[model samples]
Target: MNAISIKGLSVSYDRKTVLTNVYMDMEAGKLYGVLGPNGAGKSTLFKAILGLISSNTGQVLINGEPVEEQRKKMVYIPQKGEIDWQFPATVMDVVLMGRYPFKGIFQRLSQEDKNIALQALEDMGIANLRSRQIGELSGGQQQRVFIARALCQQADIFLLDEPFVGVDITTEKKIIEILKQLTDKGKTILVIHHDLSKVKDYFDKVILLNQWLVAYGDTEVTFTEENINRAYRGQLSILHRTTLD
Candidate 1:
């Protein structure tokens, strides 16, 4: 099944093109790594899919419906740097926000919602930190909280941006394990990632972008040296040494 479909997608900023004529059909129950250098429009693609940005000439469909109609079915976890960690919110408070989508306009969260949030925390091995301030936790713990929130929401598609940055090795392993488990249960996940070394080990497929859809398919076939060279272009020498070391 196609979880996401993009056709003739083009995005621009200040009269400059960011993503040009992009088209892709992402399948369900797969983990996809969105890879490209800085300013490659990787984030822009995510924004377009989430309806956070308007495209110059294209459409994004989620589950064969428009983005607005399917917003609740998707969960986006941006980079840690994008968040205000000192927002005076507890772990539980953040996780509970996921349930708001399913509530009536004036409805208050019920015990069932709390139970679901608690279970999400427990599953992430952070039930003990439910009362901790969001800013006080370590980077890894903070990432886990957001994943827990996604679980609480029961979203079918997940869009995560640079999720493994600034995290401990143990936490990275834990996160990949959790993501694989989600895929096993038929969840679709797309991650904007920079680490090329872990591409094969982590994702079932990859989307290589460089202001366009350079290549996309099963990792074994699409993440080859030729495609990577095409995608990275001028930074090949640096990326090859650093990523393939």
Candidate 2:
């Protein structure tokens, strides 16, 4: 079965349609890049799959089951802007939150959980900064902390929104490498990305959206000039100068 299946999904806010009759199936062990212009419903699609928002029509199935049934199997790393940097949390405190889904209502974290969280921090190369305040970290370090949390969760599917924004080149490269490694382990990942130039290198497949499903398939085959033009629409001139050439 596909990792995720969306059938006739639509969403609206205040009577303004954000997505319309979108359908797609994502497979496991692959990295999918969700591409779209601003206000193209990329984030909405993530919210729908994560069951954070009610869809106007259709359903989202995870591994052939309703999303609610598989909520613990997925992890969502939202955009940095959506987070509160001054929440007074430490690196370890944030990464340990991933284990909350596994604990019972009154259960306390065990040593094993701490070990797992520390391993994730080590994997992200931030183990030494485990006690640092979250707000004290740089953008790249902050992104790594969240990804470490996802790793600690041991979830099968990951949804990351614009992870590369505001990060250094080295950190960007490292993060992609880690994501690719996860795919190699049969984990499904979807990223909402805006850099058309890196799509070819960063993702195995592409889901082009513009308030609707435009094109989705292997990057080399589906990410063609024509499909890009169709998705970006009036933003072609800007993309041409920055990415498409």
Candidate 1 global lDDT: 0.92
For 1-245, candidate 2 gives per-residue lDDT tens digits of 99999999999999999999998999999999999899999999999999999647888999899988998889999888889999989999999999999999999999999999999999889999999999999988999899899999988999999998888889899889989998999999999998888888999999999999999999999999889989989686764646753
TM-score of each: 0.95, 0.95
As for candidate 1, its clashing pairs are none
Instruction: Identify the runs in model 1 with alpha carbons over 4 angstroms from their true place.
Output: 238-245
How high is the lDDT of residue 88 in model 2? 89
* TM-score, candidate number 2: 0.95
Scored against the true structure, residue 136 in model 2 reaches a CA lDDT of: 96
CA lDDT of every candidate:
0.92, 0.93
Collision count for each candidate, in order? 0, 0
lDDT per residue (tens digit) for residues 50-156 in model 1: 89996468999999999999988899998999999989999999999889889999999999999999999998899999999999999888998999999999898
